[model samples]
Target chain A: MSADSPAGTHPDPTLTSLDIGHPVYAALLDPDTAFWALVDKTRVADTLAGGPLRDAYRQHADACRRELHALRFELKPSGVYLNPTERCNLNCRYCYLPESQRRSGGHMSVDQLLASLSRLRDYFRSIMPEGGRPRAIFHGAEPLMNRDAVFAAIDAFAGDFIFGLQTNGTLLDDGAVSFLTARNVSIGLSLDGPSAGITDATRHTWSSRSVHNRVLAAMNRLRGYGSWSVITTCTTENLPYLTAMVELFHAREVPTCMLNAVRCTLAGARDVKPDDGAMSRAFFAALDRTHELYRDGGRKLVVANFANILIAILAPTARRLMCDISPCGAGRAFFALAADGNLYPCSEFIGLPRFKGGHLLADGGIEAALTSDAFRSVIGRNVDAFSPCDQCVIRHFCGSPCPAEAHEMNGGMTSTGVFCAFYREQVNYALRLIADGKADDYLWDGWDDGTETLIDLAH
Target chain B: MTQTVLTKPQTQRASSPSPAVAPAIAVRKTCNPDGVGLSHYVLMDKKVAR
Candidate 1:
């Protein structure tokens, strides 16, 4: 990174990984790519390529590109979301999608769902970028509650797009797992943490008893089927138990874990505001502890989402990360078709009034909805409002604000996200970890990039 | 053109109002790429946002 580079200039995420543990001064002054690009002409190549550090350098470069466009996506086709049944067996207190609406029969018929999906498939085909596949996500009170409709829609739109769903793991029977696995559909289950006390505090059945056993059973079933992993929601109650959460995954031998701060959306849990300061402490502590446990226990790093982010920023060989960086991926790459045939930017606005664009059955169907002022305005506004974001150093790497969250939190596209504080906290923690003497031992040393201390930027 | 007469020397310099008044907003310096050890330095700002 050039020191005098302007504020808006995006830093190469790849350059970030050269050395994890070395002092920044060492990394900045490394022989090959010295801070001032100052070195004797004869020694540069040997410094970067002739040592065991070569591989680290390459990995750092790869990781940077992976993170540079983490949220970069080209709109394929607009997709539709069908809220088949507004019913969930588990009654999680912090349930983002409230059950009240569903219990009142906020369900769609099979015919209605299929029709909406067909319209979405046609729309995606019309505007798809060459060979890309349009995608759709099944989110609801519990998408699995209406299995018949889901299967029918999947079968109907098999070749048109990719399908994914988010569930709470109560109804993940063997048959359902087999069906989704056979279809190659990806699934994300909601589980807070290990044990009945932790998991049951929020997620529970109608009887108000612990659903931990059931959820664990479902996880075990999915693991046997070789498909799903748990998406843990980080909250104040569970912040202290992060190490426990990671250890649980290691115990279960789960492949991966994604930790998302508890969202306080309209449908989100009540009274749960993200404590950025505390969250940062918990996250760093957990990372350090987990790293040690992995080294000692010979267990795979199950919680690598943040580490992957670091890798994306620092390593050169990592794959590109995917996310809806900006206000949301609306008409450009994706759009959500509501259960009532209304189009939305995403499923986060299924019941919210602001995102409801137009009815597919009423107007000229999906075509008009795609071009509706409401729909276009939402997308246009999201893209146009790029002020605070444009000048940030981590612009490219940090994707834009989440549209749904923006709408829900700040009441507009331009509002700073509530999660901004948390992000700042995380960045600070990463910088501090680098400053402390532990950077070399825990991060940079022996992380071979192919040559002598490949990432020894301070060489 | 008439030359302006020199003004009398004042004991105190021209007084400017202090910046820290009203509903003071708390400001904290958390660790970033620079500065001291990673910890919060809390201080109240005189100029409030509201």
Candidate 2:
């Protein structure tokens, strides 16, 4: 088809732009061999499955329908993350939950938490069977600040749901450790780095040394029960210590570390992010250091973002990597149960004026989110709307641009992020790392025939 | 027996069968077609035979 014809607007015509020839357009019909060469069939399938090709072609159309069905998880909102109190002990500059949203001293009572979670339990009951229960995350000013409310909700939903908590480690003491272990709760701590210089600058409590000392002590105490890992942010303050950070985690024997760039928010924390170039350099440096440590046969450290892209290259089926799809896990595949018993799409987009669908306590939550016009508008618009992303060759493998970042930076889901340069740099670095034989060991060398085709190409 | 109980709730939430609505903009990008090459992009909004 000619470029003038809109992609996915019309059905497959008698001939395509890929078409070799048609008498009416004899000259135009000649195949664009150069273009055809660039089209990787595997990449095309990945893109089409999640792209405009969902509507353009008909052969795998049924499969496309199933993909849509599975992707749109029309289940009850199983998890609730309450910002029980909005005032955090450690005011992380990059905190997405703005101070305006914090409840501060106004803690959510046990009854309030129970009301929200009971609605959650009922919703899950309506969606999932007994054994295939739901899960929830505890968040807020700090889940630790309102530890009793957190446990009460956990206890209320005990047999029917799993509980996980995200806390800035300042308050993670021995008692907190004991409580989590006794209840089999998973914990994710926000610890940016191994050194005081890096971690203290971003996550330190009032005492400057409080966060570092407490986090280390907490890590030691919780080393035995349930899972605990660090959630790191690459801020300007922490960028210089990338290697030190990874080495610290390696030394601590922490199994995993999720490395994320400092996301700018409306929370009035502009200074929190490092200069773009510096941040990108630091991230790449961290990736390089981790590879070095791996060669030395140290504890495994995973940079989650790269791990995801590597998985796409190396393994497609290892649980659809989260960020590969749209960001802001809205009505698509995820649901978040908020403290107010309101069911929002995902936690990140929780406070957005445009995002809240309806309350779970009122009726079934899935229908409200699924049928809402705003939510549908997002789901209906695929990778077709933006620039760079719309034309990206790696669009299929990269998934689409994160909708939240796109919304924040571009003013709409249909637009590309203004600062997409950062992501582009990361992708380029990853490609270089993989091609340089650094990521060779991670690539699968043993899949046969059918699997070999996928694995070999990734390597 | 428990599996049946679990999946039952899923069955009740039947598909609403809403009609699909097309997006306002093109979802996929294609290459230029002067019979010349695939290397060039026209950035045109419409599709046509090369």
Candidate 3:
């Protein structure tokens, strides 16, 4: 290894520079140390197909493959995502939940919710005998629709758990605000765009009014009382304005921005998923603009998706962004507990019977579900086991993405994700940011994590 | 898709202190050998190191 090698542990052998996609530098993921760095395009041949250097690269790559394997089998729990009901007020075009289930009027009764909470508590105890509180994030098809059950579930756990609510935000009135605020719930509102024009088109509402105004009001109300963040689902409708949308959020004093690119998990999303090049450029532009604001405007705004990529690059172990983790945190770190006591790795996998772990209503079920074959199947998936991901340079940084989305869009969990182009572009762009010495601009920890302030741990 | 024009590695030592733990990050910043060192960063989201 050259002492001056960008990857200090891996030798950088000089060669003729190739005008590869990475341009001036090729970002290398050092499998031996699980570290990444940008080497001169001329020096990257050390790891490319050749002699001794290539042999060493292959050896380290094998080690990285094994590390991914370990991560997949490790079922360490961070929290649980609870779906109180399938009933939603808006008919969001990008909703991945089966329409039949969402309209079935099925819900977990207060008793069942309490029972589920009790089981969830037991799950925490099983995983952490030292007494660590688990996060109970009440997710949607408008979890607020089943008001009583959602509240009861919260009351049952009370101070024993950290709570969060991922809602459409239309139903978060004063009463709901007081209830969640009293319990210190971290609120994550889903608003696709900055205003009604883009949002209303994708997230439909039956009434004559706009969903954006309702959500904006909800955001303001919560921000006044406590911690809150907005999750912007990027699609073709909103792709062009991603940077502007995030800038507006920052201007409004929102703490964090979680940019979730629309995945082809369902028909609603498949139809609206942005073009690969468009999505990448939009997200990069968002990161670039927001990071500029965050740096110049006193480091208040956090573009979490961009920060997550940096974190995955800088410190892989500390990353909680599920989609970026190889094999993901799906069944291991968290599982989505549906309204009817059924469990899936995450909400996106809800209606898929093959991914169902088990029913939470069953005896000793939470523990049993964690060990179920179905759960294992989802958790056991690794990016290295797949085809092209193993050959790619940014495998560790991107994680190939959600298995549920992969299985839904493609054929299986191991198949190349539909977002491959999107991931490559984002990773390359992010690395370029780092190459330009702008990591600090987007790398932030402005929020106090002790209370889970605005940070969606499982997002 | 902005392509970075390849420039020869600068041998000039960066005045910035070497980042500890994750030296590759700082090393890549200036492409300087002296910039590599030890230390890790703590983001807002921290867990017990596995």
Candidate 1 wrong stretches, greater than 4 Å: A1-22, A25-81, A129-131, A224-226, A267-270, A297-299, A302-308, A311-324, A361-367, A370-373, A376-391, A428-459, B1-50
Output the number of the TM-score-best candidate.
3
Interface RMSD of each: 25.4, 24.1, 15.5
DockQ of each: 0.01, 0.01, 0.05
Per-residue error at A308 for model 1, in Å?
6.0
Worst 10 residues of 3 chain A by lDDT: A450-459
Assess the local accuracy of residue A212 in candidate 3 as a C-alpha lDDT between 0 and 100. Answer: 88
The predicted structure with the larger lDDT, 2 or 3, is 3
- Judged by DockQ cut-offs, the docking class of candidate 3 is incorrect
Q: Residue by residue across B14-39, what tens digits does model 1's lDDT show?
A: 34684221110101111111100000
Model 3, residue pairs in steric clash: B20-B38, B20-B39, B21-B38, B21-B39
Which parts of model 2 have CA positions greater than 4 angstroms off? A1-82, A103-105, A206-210, A224-226, A363-366, A377-381, A399-401, A429-459, B1-50
lDDT at residue A145 of model 3 (Cα atoms):
88
- Pick by lDDT: which candidate is best? 3
Question: A1-459 in candidate 3: lDDT tens per residue?
Answer: 111223224344322222326445555555323445455555566545455433444444433334343444443776778888877788888788887776665887888888888878876876764656767788878889898888887887886677778888899998998888886777778788877898887886745357888888887786654466678888989988898898888877877768878767786688888878888888878877886786687755777776677655544543446567666777776778988789887777887888888898787587778788888887767766678776666676777877877888888888877778887776666666665565556755421222111111110
lDDT of each: 0.51, 0.50, 0.65
C-alpha displacement of A379 in model 2, angstroms? 4.2
- Candidate 1 chain A worst ten-residue window by lDDT: A30-39
